[model samples]
Target: MPVLSTVGGSGRSTVAGLLACALSAMGSTVVLDTGPRLSSPWPAWSSEPGTGLLSLPPDRPLTRGQVHAAASRFPAPDGGSWQVLTDHQEWSHPPLPLPSDPAAWYQLSAIGGWQAVIADTVHPVAHDVLTARWADSTGLTARWCHLPFSVPVLCAASTGSGVLALQTAVKAASAEGLPLHRMVVALAAVGEGRSPASVKAAATMLEPRVRAVVQVPYDPRIRAHGIRDTSRLKSRSLEAGRQLARAVVSSAEAAWGDPLPAAAVPRTRAAAQARVHDTARIASKKVPA
Candidate 1:
């Protein structure tokens, strides 16, 4: 299972939802809202309110049957299926379920063969549980952790402290030898125009710790409406969201040495070629016209 932990403020819920949407679009079965409290309803979970990811009995090791049963609940888009697990009870203390052994918790997750697990772990209990798990296992990979591109995003009146807490958690994970795949820097609000300078500065500051920095431009629809299960997003915003999601998936694929499907290879190459041609044309036009 490829698990991608999303660490950010309340805004992270939107990112997690968008990431799940992107993976689903690519034909990958993705489990969303695996944490205690689901941030958004996108990629809806079938588990009843009282039962969630954290509710599973730690004494009884998770079995393939249980995995299948849990997965059966969430009907995947287009015919495929993805397991959607929530945290037991809307909120709980860290180390969800209070796993007697932290390693067992991760082992259970690894058994699912999940292509990706996007968690919006913003609360203290959620953060503590994740931190403990990361501490217990030095071998697990840290795909990406989302952050704000500017101070304003962190200081915004509505913003919470989860962003800062997530940063600290990432730092701790990095010190333990887990690779920080990338730091996704998102703007505080949409339609605020591109803040290139802030984005660049954020990338520079985070470069030392992460493999790369990804900039997710402010998309008003995401901020205004929040995550939704349907595919009725504004066309422009949907396109932009897809672009960011593609970049993240591509990076993850490269890290894991996974090959893109044969059907997608040609299209991927053509897209690369188109970018090159576009760049060349821009340079040529700037020469004299």
Candidate 2:
């Protein structure tokens, strides 16, 4: 699934982290980081040494183990965690060839092991449908929209302008033949006194049109510290994450018109070895009295 918004500060990363954390309860979850050029907060929040998305193999058919190994861990609930793969380059270093296409991002999540993958995407994919960028629609934005068995989690700030942008975005996406019927919309609270009439009205109109419209409550912690500490997030915020996850699955089910197919491919032996090493490292953290 891809978490996207046409505008910035729509809480894409926060939603992504929450969804990843909430989805981890179902099984293993991993995050395909959104930022590479300017970068996301994945590095700052992570304690482990970052392997980075660039560290992943450049081949078309990537090895699941190697790809998984490159991910940086983010703590989740119940002692479990999710993985994030992003650029950890320094400011002075010359930029490397990063994977800008949706194919590369999609490939990382599809390799295997993870039961759920949340792709944190900042690109205005829906907005692209109405722009000159639509000519090359076979790339990132369109790919996210048209990919099979995929669900798009459209996010918007709970404000007048934000809702307006989302309304336009959804309309453009529908015009481009994207699955608006199976899409999930998220309204992120911007700490306003209350949702403006426009935002509320849009949600009401879009509710029956889309799968579901969820309102993510404003959490002061998210704004002050970013999405690093999931444990400290408010209960309402976490509940919203769970709601988004369920909504995503429900939309997927609606698209399938039946039970969704399960992932059956086994992870590589190398992946198992990696897990063993990870377990050993975690165990090494404990000290005897």
Candidate 3:
């Protein structure tokens, strides 16, 4: 699963951290940091000195076993353990090349000791290693400055380039046999700033465009202390995280569609070429004069 925001400041990283923690409370979960924005707050929040994915040598592609070994455990108050894999601050390494094979990336979560893997990625992967096709589901974050029905609530074309970018990525991924389960997170509504009617309206408005809509109230605790500080987390934010996790898990389970299929085949040379062709076609359709 990829936690992606079309634009910056949609609180994608915050959501990813909470989602990973919530998932961990239920089962083993690892959050792979592939984005450049903000580093995973796990290290700052955890009591133990931790290791990150970037700690491993970047000379060769990382293996699932290696990934598992390198993961730093962050224990939740409920006794569940959350693991995080990110770059280490101590080492100066070159930009790492993510696994080019989407299937292999997918297999990492399916086969390993982990129950789920949350991939934190930047938007517009045109230059990034993790392309849209690599994701089985995308947690898209959209900001709502208004309290109720407003113009461009779902996709403010003039203000939000992320909407179009996300739509394009979803379409392209679908074309490549990866149907993205879109979990839209509506952000920046606090206690009085949020109401049941507003939340319901937002979900209803987004229902047609996304699989599910989850609203996370803006918590001053998280904003001030960062996501790593669990001690000061607000109850409302925690509940929202749990809700989002349940929705994501349910969507994933439903996608399996009873009697999960056998393991997927690796991407062969021919398949890679076909993917290139498909991507080129998609690009051609969008290119302007």
Candidate 4:
């Protein structure tokens, strides 16, 4: 599934990285960086830094067979195979342009044999070219939103702006006959912001619209460094990342019916949201005065 944000700076990239790493630890995984940027976080903390999708020539038409042939395996903690397909160029001065056609990239990835393919998209509405294309091709896209109460959280806009962008994304998906099925809401407590009650209330508003809602808790370390900098993550942050990963895995299985290895049973929606509320408390408790 392609992971996208309604607005920029929604921690979508961070969530994408965590999800990719977690799935990689479980089984075969591939992460494709489709964001239009000079740099990507995946290479910073990735076990194998140099190997990426950039190895494939941008001048030529990309194919699934070509992508599979170019894919490089990265080491996961569980001794599983993790492949990272980054679009960042090795040359720092002149950055290479990421592929413009999201459809082709999605097709290439769909053909490749990867348990899960997470594409870190820029945005679903204004600046994004990937999610619209992905949604059109697959009729589905997973949105990652933080601070859904119309408040500014990270680099993203207010919750209202994010929701508006989400509506646009949903419309695009609907045009393709695939209404959005799942969404991941990050209740990040970066500062003294929304209360747990308010967060839950916001989630409540969204629960009825989507099939599954994955809630990611705020981890201060993630806010500080980045998701790729796993070394800087504390116990709470690490646990949060693990929890987010598990949610992604479970959601993917439910959405695609892809057989996942035996793991914890997926939690009920109410139970999962309750955990998110509990996470808000833990995050607040751990915050420095």
Counting clashing residue pairs in each candidate, in order, gives 4, 0, 1, 3
Which pairs of residues collide in model 3? 53-86
Candidate 4 has its poorest 10 consecutive residues by lDDT at 146-155
Candidate 2, 140-258: lDDT as tens digits:
65677666577888899999999988988888787677778878899999894788899999999999888999999899998888778788889998899999999988888777865
Model 4 per-residue lDDT at 138: 31
Pairwise lDDT winner, candidates 1 and 3: 3
RMSD (Cα, Å) for all candidates, in order, is 17.5, 12.2, 11.3, 18.0
Per-candidate TM-score against the hidden true structure: 0.52, 0.84, 0.63, 0.62
User: Residue-wise lDDT of candidate 1 within 1-289, one digit each (tens)?
Assistant: 2233324343555545555655665654434343433343532433323245543565555664565444423332344434455554443355453333323333444455454555433334234445657577422233222211100011111123433444555565556544455434343333455454544454466657554443444555556555433244555544544654665655556654466332211123346688999999997884654
**Distance (Å) between predicted and true CA of 99, model 4?**
2.1
Model 2 worst lDDT run, 10 consecutive residues? 132-141
Pairs of residues clashing in candidate 2: none
Order of the predicted models by lDDT, top scorer first: 2, 3, 4, 1
List model 3 lDDT by residue over 218-266, tens digit each: 7888777666655468887778778778777666556554443443433
Best by lDDT: 2
Candidate 4 lDDT over residue span 1-289, tens digit each: 5566656656677666666656776666777777644545655545545435656664455556677656555554445556667654455545755665555455456556565666666644433335446544331232222111111112222255444565555455445444344444444444444445544555576557554444555667667666554555555555655766665555556654667443222233457689999999898885667
Given candidate 2, what's the lDDT at residue 281?
98
